[model samples]
Target chain A: MRERRIIAIASGKGGTGKTTIAVNLAAVMEGPVAYVDCDVEEPNGHIFLKPAITAANSVAIPVPIVDKEKCTGCARCVTACRYNALACVKGRVLVFTELCHGCGGCMLACPEHAISECDHEIGVVETGRANDICFVQGRLKIGVAMSPPLIRAAKAASPSEGTVILDAPPGTSCPVIAAVKDSDFVVLVTEPTPFGLHDLTLAVDTVRQIGIPFGVVVNRCDIGDDRVTDYCQREEIPILIEIPDDRRIAEAYSRGCMAVESLPDVRPFFLQLDLRIRDLLSAPNGVQSAT
Target chain B: MKELVVVSGKGGTGKTSIVAAFAALTPSKVLADCDVDAADLHLVLQPEIRSRNEFRSGHEAVIRQDACIGCGACLVNCRFDAIRTVSNADLAWMFGAGIHACNDCDVCVRSCPLRSLDMINAMREASGEARKTAFVVDPISCEGCGVCVDICPVKAISFPERVSGEWFISDTRHGPMVHARLGIAADNSGKLVSLVRQQARQLAQDQNKEFILVDGPPGIGCPVIASLTGASLVLIVTEPTLSGQHDLQRVAELARHFRIPAVVGVNKWDLNPDMTDAIEAAAVTLDATPVGRIRYDRAVTAAQVAGKSVLEYSNNGVADDIRNVWAAVSALMQLDKPKANREAP
Candidate 1:
């Protein structure tokens, strides 16, 4: 089996064309590729390719359950919980399940060994395909809250194979952190605007904090501010590709078509971006691929 | 007093523009930007921070590694597996901070024969603070329960039931205006937003002002719910991109969710006419009035560059749309014609 090289496409600023690059890059890759759209809060990768979901399963996280029969009510469980999940209220112990983070603190805290673990629905992981590319997507139910667990689930469901691409969520928050955590390399898609640069700085800080190798892709190259390029230069981050601002590209996006799919001429651009990504990966001891 | 938040499910959809424009039509109003994660309203609204503070998220326990005597007592006392032979203060960093929130659990300190474990303030950063009043839960730290929220525990940081943004009472050419800047990532934005409105209401009452305007946050979350809770009226600003239509329906649905009357202002309507119409229709479905449409203006972009609001910039084809939208919103609020549309960017 070929090693699955995970490529996470992330940008702190939304609408900066992260998904645009993710879908098309997969379409242009050689061999069998698996795409994981980990932007659970708002997964739009499927919107472009409109993947017909072949399999989907609800993802759940573990929550603790106290077996009162084994209870000593020592209150150690209450004190051990960091999430404020277990509480001693007046004469009775109260467990607010929503507040639970399920770190197994309370389970070990019980001297009587009363606490057991239960499953709580956190989100759903979806498996599907777009064209010849095998795809996995995570959909966080609105108002259900939390996207990181689903992001992890989607990554876990990824098919082992050729280049794997992950479409990350906007912003350098926890979900973004989770989506890009174990990737081989990260491609930050951005535009040449002050807003984009400001957010790109945050994303750069995040990738650095997590200790990952990354490069920059400036979408809509000619529009807005030039501060993005200046920062990339100052930071010593490599600029891989610069796709110019064109109305035809926007039109294709509006019609729910991939840039490479609609404009086959631009297919070369994705190919080049992919080649550069591979070259960067093979160059160093950093970010060993999780084959 | 009513609190109103402006949010879009999608990003860069002009949520702030509509709020700034709304500030033009009202008598006296305070604004709060709750998107602490990617706050850019200051680029246009020009918030002058009166004060700032350090926001500490959690506690860090450091071990005096050389204290000797590995009695294994600290491990026994530590309910969390955070303490180990290799890592003294914590073998498991993910362990409970319950030591302080810890109900007199001296098990760690007392049980530690080596006396190496010491609990100290962990992660602290200098953050922005202001108080016209808006408590914005830090977007980076704010998470609904069940999703393990990464937070600071040094001080066991819990926000005030009411933390407000720095209050701004300024004189604009149009009328008296109010606004504020929230710290990098505070919480209880709903409460702080209500403070802005209450302050605005008080200012209006003191001055016998006829209106109280507000600039709200984006999206339909708790903050958005708070933004529309008791507002007399709302004006939703949106772009004409595909995401614009998608977000407009969601935001309008949120406004209707809280029973706040809302009006519409389509910023950069010329970017996508068909999408703009779709937004109008969506607003109608939510019973929100489609007030007016603004064309895509390079002037609006230039205005941000000059550090000024569009109203303060050249009154060209786009400014008319802003003026018209202001009129429609005021009319919906059962008011007279707006005297002037003033802005400070």
Candidate 2:
């Protein structure tokens, strides 16, 4: 009866372990969990889960279609477009669907009322279940330049159930924005190198801007420098868990398994991480975790 | 111009690291950070910005309250659910939700019986600021996509080119770094990335440098696509983890999409050798050579703390991996193979 807590794993910097945490945490959630890989351009959670494909669908964005018979070649649509996607060249309107943001400016501007809305397939959305965990992913149709539309589609596929973990796209770009929207908590994972620390700072900044409750999980703790820890401490950010550098764990991961999957003992650590996050989200004061 | 993007689908997979390393390893590669929201390569490369530009997106609605009347018609046609009726104050304060979220079609201005509402070119929130620096470029991605330039019921979204900034030429230790910084929140950043890389190419040609390393932004979005065009090779830096494996596959597949040769380097390989080996196996499937397997070494962190490349750091195990990586890179690019002299572009 309670609202299923939604936790999003996002990083402004890619390769910061957002999906790693998402799939593993979902795999270990005590309650039924739904995992959505919002990184449609490159959905990787399926790689780890190897889910059976239940349904595969394409995501389309609305684009303007010019009815050649109706078009007067007046250049109204071309002039109306701010993106230059629609251009009247040599007395004909040329539409670059990839460049089109589907603003419908040209459709409304046509003197002949020639333009109508058409659907352009941007990518494919895959829906399936693996290991008893519901899963959905988006694969941008080959050469589909835009991703936010697809990311939005995958998020729309949420199971509306117990708990949901969204594995977000990397970086604080539009795709990242699309992935993290409407999530209850965000888990930012990073290593302890300068590269990690630098990117962690950016990811934390992005989460803060999105106005979400988030914490840090420093993986490969022993290998990298302490700058990440020092940054977290200075920023007053909570350090959820420090996953030490261990080769065996690495080997397990390389074999297409979550370290927690191969080693059930780490499940307790994830559980603890989840508890801390829940507490942070439920804090009466709604305090922002300080750095 | 050839674009050699650096990408690893997995989060925290060293995509940026190898990009930065490549920037350092090569002398003339142009650089573009497609990850506008959370750009970090500048932290390592230290590109000096030269220009700043504003990136305007769609228009937000603004209600000009000077005339009068609180009619409900303005509230009826709004599709975005943006308009709200507040207690009647002086006409201005009453309709005071600025255009931050408004679509500005002047629908409210027309619908109001008293003609109290007015919709101008309502400026929406800016995407972000940009600064074009030497060796680095920061293009703020305007969150607004100018979509609201449509049925504002109010005609709110304004498609305007507010002056964001200009390009910059900076000097880096590696060589001349070509970069740009757009005024924060500008749209069409992928094109701007193309512009920066174009400059990098020009600079590399002028210098006759053999390499142009680039640190590509994350995800397979527009900027990533721009970063991938026409590159002789791609070096995908990845980690050995569930996410890393997933990202590696995607980036590899992405490289395949571009039909460019890809090379893989698993950073912190020792931390997850089995994963590292598996990644190597995947790289083989990708048909790109697995250049080097970097160990998870404390020295890497120390080197970063010291503000130096791993190659420039103490000759640690990680450094050896870097050396081996460079050696393999030479082999892949045929940089070491003897060749007949050719005309310069």
Candidate 3:
């Protein structure tokens, strides 16, 4: 059996073309492929892929429910909670569901056995398909604080047997970690500008710390100076493919069109990217697959 | 003091660049870099650290090696897959002599039939790896539910706070700036952003500054919400891309939901003029004033490379556009001053 790889397209900075790379790769790849958009806070892959929703699952976190009838408010649960999700005021345990991490610590801390968990839905994961590509995305309900759980749920929905392409959220934080963790290889998308290089370096550190083999693809490669290229060369990080600053690409992207479909000539770039990732996966060491 | 938080629902939409430009344009104001995750404003602002403090937000679980009986209770109960049984060889390789630390789920303590497993202080025990393979907490994955704490039968489990990140008060050319860095995979960025904002506001008050400009993170998550809360105005920088339009609507709606007025500016607007117009129309529909449209200029990147704001790098059309936008923003804020004061009582 051929090895099935999960490739997470991520960037430390937002709007660095992670979704662009992810959606385009999914579009160009042949055979079985799954695209999971874990950027729950602002999932935009759907706009580009236009996946039709076939199923929807609500993702929830368990928050402590105080049984008032069982009634001895010792505030033990409150003391055990680190998130300040539970507070005891005047013998009343106010359960702040939004603040809860759903760690179930409060339930275990409750000596009276009065605390039980109830599900608080934070977001939803929708599964669908765009042409031959299997698609899934997590969408956090506005004003929801927690996203890692939802991102996990969305990621879990991807088919395990296929090549899974994950579109990660921006930032070098927990949410990005959650989205990109456990991937076989990470494609760190970045721009060639100073901000891009700075954030790209951070993303590289994160992927390196997570012990994953990864490479970089510089978007708008023609626009920014060679700083990103210089840094990548200095650090011995492979520059996989560079997407030039093209106005038509941006226009097509603005209309919610994937580059593979809008710019047929660009198909080879994504194809080469796919081959590069596959080559890296098949290599004994992923770090040396840059060429 | 009034707060103007610059955010983009999408990343790389020129929020930090614009914030840096604004910092250059507006002197003698407190600046806060609330995008604790992937904070890059410091790269441009070049703030010299004045004061630094550790941010110990949450707890991770640790196990005492001498107390651990080698039971697999923690390994089984860890929902985060943070706990794992290390082979003797790997343990030998990692620590010359010491037991592994256990993450504080406390399940092993409760499930230990021999009553040998005990919870140790997460911060202290984890730091001092006494038992190389005995107890361990994967700090990145531990959600701090305290489940293991309750389940510990030997009463060995104890939760200790871990330093998640650091926040700093710094001196910049613009003035005092507040910023923070979240520990790798650390949670509670919203809290950290809140802390930085709190400090920025306090500094503004102390300094008698008129503005508290914030460089907010991309996306409408907890940190973004924290950045937007109680702000006088929100300027959303967006690009002329499809995702940009979609994200702008989402963030604009978020600002509207919070009853905080938002203004929109399209960066790299020349990338797609039609899309820019469409975004402007959408912004109007969302009640977000389309304040400015910056053409796709190489000068922006050149300015960034020069470690200078576009305004300082070039006295060009793009810089003029940024200045015009600031003018509109200041004027809009001036009109809002009375309403804010009226509501203060």
Candidate 4:
């Protein structure tokens, strides 16, 4: 049996080639692999992978639906809610579905049993296949404020026993945390510039707090200075791979083409990356630093 | 004051770079970096910190282990599954048992006929003591909803405000700038973004600046919404890619939903000119004006690496493109006319 590993490619700063690395890595992997795009707000993996849609599942969360007939306008639900999802306007209860976290606190607090739960569609989870690899992505409904639930739905649709590569959203906030957490290993892709180094440190802090083993992969390594590599060495974090600033790769990416499939020169880099990840995971100490 | 916000629905289509260039071009402006999660405009503007303030919002539950009576109230009521149970033996291993001096009497130790001291020491060393479970709150999972704090039977849980991030007021070469940094793994960035915008408005009022230029975050989510809600105008910077077009439509819809006028600028338009034309056409249908197109330029990155805006680095190529975009945006904003003249007589 092949060892199952869930790897997340994440970059705190936007436009650092996170999806580029994720799709190319999936293209180079052998056998049955799963690719999950957790960047629900702006998912780009579909543009590169061009997966054929086999199924689409609408992801919804439970929001409070008030039964006015059973009502005593006690305002308990409004007071109990921490998110300001419920309001008492002119002795009537108003539900702001967008503000609700869907925690069901309002339902639990309703003394008159007036609050009931209803499914509120926030996004859709689409499942399909791109060649031998199973592909899943979350598309958040336009104007939806929350994306973590949709991201979770996409991850849940992924095959449990396989090599799963999750392309995480940029930033170190809740959405990024939801996408990257629970992965066996994480690949932090970054450029070597000041913006990249700054955001990389925040991402490192996030993954370290989650207690996940991670390594760095610097994209466009030749474009910026060597501070990123120097920082990794000082922190004892492994530098898995460095992809040079290649115009061909950028052109391929802009045209919605996978680099591994379009550029022969890029294939070797991704293949080598796969080998390094497997070797590191199988090592005794793994890639986790002492800090 | 009239406000202009620059947003990119997709990540890294050169929103910050353009905003920095606009800051350099426009003199009577207050700048704000509303991308609190991974703020990078400060890198280009090189703001000198004038004041830094902590941003606190919401509350997370904290359990007092000493007061907890091993009740399951909080664990059962938490909807987020943020509560966790750990055996007392495990806690003792991690954090030592509160075994101080029992008044130095040693009566219990001496009274046992089986030599309880040896047994007690052995149990502590081997972590084999009888286990009593204690509850704890996982900070990440806790939505700071206060449900656990309210449901605890023994009132052992205390809800305290969370220090989500920090906001800063700073001085730059061009003007005063407002920005923030959301704490690692913290929530409520939308709130922080709003606070930063508010501060920028206040600073602009104080300094008598007529314009406020805001660099908004990527994605059409909470922080992005917060940045552009009441702004006078919004300029969406996007690239010539399928993903970029898809995200641009959503963000343009967001601006329209909020009733804010929007304009679009295609960055790296030379990478895929066909897609650029398609995106501009789509932007028009979405009621967004296509203002300008910027060719793919390495000088943008070069200028970023040198910590200078492209306009400041050189006045050719992308710099000229940015100047054209700014001119169109300002014309839409009617900034060439004095504020008093534009007002109703």
lDDT of each: 0.63, 0.66, 0.83, 0.86
> Lowest summed lDDT over 10 consecutive residues: which window, candidate 4 chain A?
A282-291
Query: Which residue runs does candidate 4 get wrong by more than 4 Å?
Result: A1-3, A284-286, B87-131, B335-345
For model 4 the local lDDT of residue A213 reads: 85
TM accuracy, model 2:
0.79
| Ranked by DockQ, top first | 3, 4, 2, 1
Cα misplacement distance, residue A181 of candidate 4 (Å): 1.0
> Residue B23 error for model 4, in Å?
0.4
**Please, what are the lDDT tens digits per residue for candidate 4 over residues A1-291?**
766789999988898999999999999998779999999988889898889999999999899999999868889989989999999988899999999888877876777889899999999999999988899999988878888889888999999787999999999999998898788888999999888998999999999988888899999999888889999999888889999998888778878899998888889999999998888888848664523
* DockQ values, each candidate: 0.18, 0.39, 0.64, 0.61
User: At residue B151, what lDDT does model 4 achieve?
Assistant: 55
Give the Cα error of residue B222 in candidate 4, in Å: 1.4
lDDT, candidate 2, B1-345, per-residue tens? 344556665555555555566666665455666544455666666766654444433333344443122223334333223344444434433233333434454544544545432322211222121211111001122333333334344332334444433556676666666655543223355776677677677777787765666667665668767877676677788887766766677778877787767888888887766777888998899877788887776665566666666566666576677778867875766642212122235
DockQ of 4: 0.61
> Which one wins by lDDT: 1 or 3?
3
Candidate 3 local lDDT, residue B294: 83
Which numbered prediction scores highest in lDDT against the true structure?
4
- RMSD (Cα, Å) for all candidates, in order, is 10.3, 8.2, 5.6, 7.6
Tell me the native contact fraction for each prediction.
Answer: 0.09, 0.50, 0.74, 0.60
